[model samples]
Target chain A: MAMYVVGHKIPDSDSICGALAIAYLKNQIGEEAIPTRLGDVSPETQFILDKFGFTAPELKMSYAGEEVYIVDHTEKTQAPDDIDEATVVGVVDHHKLGDLTTSTPLECWIRPVGCSNTIVKMMYDFYNVDIPPAYAGIMMCAILSDTVIFKSPTCTTADIKCVEALAEIAGIEDYKALGMEMFKVKSAVQGTPTRDLVMRDFKDFDMHGNLVGIGQLEVIDLSVFDEIKADLAADIIKLKEEGKRHSVMLLLTDIMKEGSLMLIASDNETIIADAYGVTVENNEVWLDGVLSRKKQVVPPLQDGFANA
Target chain B: MAMYVVGHKIPDSDSICGALAIAYLKNQIGEEAIPTRLGDVSPETQFILDKFGFTAPELKMSYAGEEVYIVDHTEKTQAPDDIDEATVVGVVDHHKLGDLTTSTPLECWIRPVGCSNTIVKMMYDFYNVDIPPAYAGIMMCAILSDTVIFKSPTCTTADIKCVEALAEIAGIEDYKALGMEMFKVKSAVQGTPTRDLVMRDFKDFDMHGNLVGIGQLEVIDLSVFDEIKADLAADIIKLKEEGKRHSVMLLLTDIMKEGSLMLIASDNETIIADAYGVTVENNEVWLDGVLSRKKQVVPPLQDGFANA
Candidate 1:
């Protein structure tokens, strides 16, 4: 059986690059695995793929009865549509374990580390497989992207070590320049559709019983939010009205400033205000020093929903 | 920051003994971990504990903020009430992964072996920690209980190896005799309240938005079901009326005969009849050669519910 290695839907740079790194490792260990994706590559991920001279993996919407290995995410909602029914053989992830149930026990390695590619680097060490320069380059890019160049709260010492070791393996003199190049691509969203822009790095959360959708878009300029704030608000309203979610939020993150301009569309404004202890003025608020949505946004929203 | 090692609620032989084994291994590795239980130990589990001169672990209903290491199971529903809020450190389980989400990544080892203790035996091997005779005895008993003396469909070659090795380690010349002793205690439900009898080994399932509960009680004699059939039916009805479940079923399994008298209480009897191609006679049917609820009962019931 061919094992399809895939990351989460709404593929981020870490997820896309992590899938490739894992597929490469699995093949080195004599497994017939193909790197795959559940969604289109985001601009940030596309930049990494182009930089590494790698093609985007074939997009698969469903994984019904397919033998697959998952990386970067383990949430059922974030996985392929038929992920629950798929024969999942292995998973390598760094995020919180989500509601993914497998039929039989599988090889799952979920480290509390920040980046999935960081864990993949450990796998390379475990197998004594030499990392190719291109693979190392993309893997290093994934770490920098997910950890926000070692600035995110999720970044750990292991992530830092992986960055240093991988940069050496990839023969990169200045890792900071590569990180800046990646972020420059992340911040280039001038002409992108508002829907694609919001959905580029989106994830759904089950807040108590409510389905909450949170999307993030990073930019160098905070004025980008001011330019597209009205359109983003309208799209959030449309998504909320679609009856799929109780709340839909977009985090327009200023990567340089290390803060986010939160655009929210929900029935309960007080709950949103109480979640972050920030007042909502016309459906927007500035969340200072909020770089990670998995850490900051999801938890408080879960608490708010629990209290509500 | 002590780690509390716990098993699922409605503690079974494997869950209880597995927690103790993992706690022992953790201590051997220089971790401050205490063995804890989510519910009262069953008669079979108690028999194993008594035979090994081990105390029942402290019962905990909730784990709000404690650092915990889970064994035997990983389902949120099976865990302590506040498991979602707990800081989970490590997990060693053999069952299908469930909806247990942690804020950070942790060490997780889930194998397809029949018993969780079988994986724990592997852990003992990996850590080069010596397994005490008493711990080995209890762990062997757990394997026998969960695997039904290697008759369970869930059992693998790893489980067989563990059984042989552990039986030798525990100095048991006749593993069958030990297995019989455990099953004897399992079959001793003569004086148990019907509600307690049914709930003793019960587990809940969310079958496509339907809350389904399936319980199993193994007996040496099939005649026990005749004596408790009406009472069991009444208790099932009471549980169904409680509105927590859409379906409630009890598998009164005869270990010697290798068959189960399934006593089901649900709004849809035709679905049950269709699931197994057996007619429901007075709300019960004999499922010959069906020893596993996880393998046989739950899947068909889930499919039947989906079709219904």
Candidate 2:
């Protein structure tokens, strides 16, 4: 008689929305489906929640002792305090598996399509739940976040199905038009705080076969970043002092131009220096002509990490 | 020869990724697509970029005084600093239209389903671009954000199509499995700042007749919000003084038991007295048997706003 709370990691619209949707579904099936969070949500996540009128989820450090299920994120369900030694009764999600260890078997619904939200949307479609406007907004937010409104390469047929269904439910006059407006509105971020800036744009990478973290900050007008660059550099220095494997890389990129001005701070200064052939000034330095960090910086970083 | 840079108001993954995808697509079709941001990204966004080894985006205040063929945002091509005056070359999006004004018609692909990223993915699918692993991860992230991983009603058939296509192109062994992992990453404020606690989970509301703003902050663990109830009250009081609205209410909800602790900060304090027969205490209060803000609190707020 234990309820399971679950969600995705480093959550965005999909993980948060999927958790809520599935929790609602589990409630219908007579199970206490607790929608849980593993970390703080991104700015886009608030948009998703507000769109759905879903009260943002309560945050938890991990899902170790509680009876937890997985969603959106892959396998980091190793919380020993909350979800300890318990079996997950039901599970549904879409993402690559990370670090998960379970002692018991459970009902896992993992689809290889677009989004896990799509699966839950299908469930709602099958059950004929009245698609609320707020929920519709949340669904659309997830689609936008996950697929970048279908620009990224991880979308699928099932994801598209859910989008259409949600659109129909939303009674959208013209989705394509709205999509642009929404995106345009989302793109404008004039005076957000430094902390918010840090959390908005990020990515993951494999550093010499070990998981590493890299982040980006796009300042359309480098003036905004220039004002805060010193503070940002200080934060990176602190992170480096903590001896973490992650690298804090900032790209003063000009959207109107093809090149970027890169700023990097890492513990292994030599590692970064060797990779980019750049010098560090006061534990901070900038790189120019950087457009594709994945295609460029990461490769070299990985090479350095591997060589080390 | 000039490229237009656009970002959403809150700038989610879609806002940034869509900008990039649309820009890339436009460039393919021989147009300059600039990835612009209204403001900077948050730490979470940086994480996504870091994972993908990318930058946030160039900051662009507005689309005013711009001349470019917009894509993936709106169909109204002549949105002069509004959703109405921009020139749209192509409208490949997945959002419902709202108060959108179009001076002239354009070739708009306003699909009622799927994420805009999926539309961009379709184009990429056509081109058969080799999606890097991290970029693949971002595409997945966008899908998760947009569809809530398929939980919300805004999803569509097109979203699913993109998801399947992306999973293949991204080389995901099991898309669904990965989704579970991603979704399991929880998003909540455990040690967040008082301001963040109040604002992070907030959602803006368009009061029935008035279109100002209303936000809700759910405190799943009532104790946490209660700890800073006084400070939160002060913040709300400040909000009332600064905002141009009659009522701005905050619902400190506990989702586990479907109950709420309400906090009202507005000019019309009697609304709380009239609606729930509760006296306002230093602009802080609570409501019994109140679970859903939309279901309960908003109606009273709407009535209060309307009558006022």
Candidate No. with top TM-score: 1
Provide the lDDT at A55 for model 1. 96
Which stretches of model 2 miss by more than 4 angstroms? A2-4, A62-64, A75-86, A89-93, A111-114, A122-133, A156-158, A176-191, A200-211, A216-226, A250-263, A267-308, B1-308
Poorest lDDT segment (10 consecutive residues) of candidate 1 chain B: B96-105
Tens-place lDDT per residue, model 1, B1-308, is 77999988898888889889999899988998899998888988888999989999888777788999988777776888888678889888876676677655577777767888988897898678999999999999999988899888888998999989998999999998989988888888888888899899999877768787889998888786667778988999889879678788899888788888888898877888898999898888989999988777866776677667
Candidate 1: CAPRI quality band: acceptable
Give one digit per residue, the lDDT tens place, for model 1 in A223-291: 866677788889988988885688899999888899988999987888989989988999989999998
- How many backbone collisions does model 1 have? 1
DockQ of candidate 1 (2 decimals): 0.41
Q: Candidate 2 lDDT, tens digit per residue, A1-308?
A: 54656564456567788777777777776777777776677655775566556787778655444566666543332222444345444455554223343322233344445566776675565456666666676776677555545543456766666777788777765665555555444445557666466545544544545545555543334555656767666665555446454566655554334355666665567788888887777665556555444445655776577669
- Residue lDDT tens for model 2, B61-136: 5565464433334312212245433443334445422223222222233344535676567556545565556666
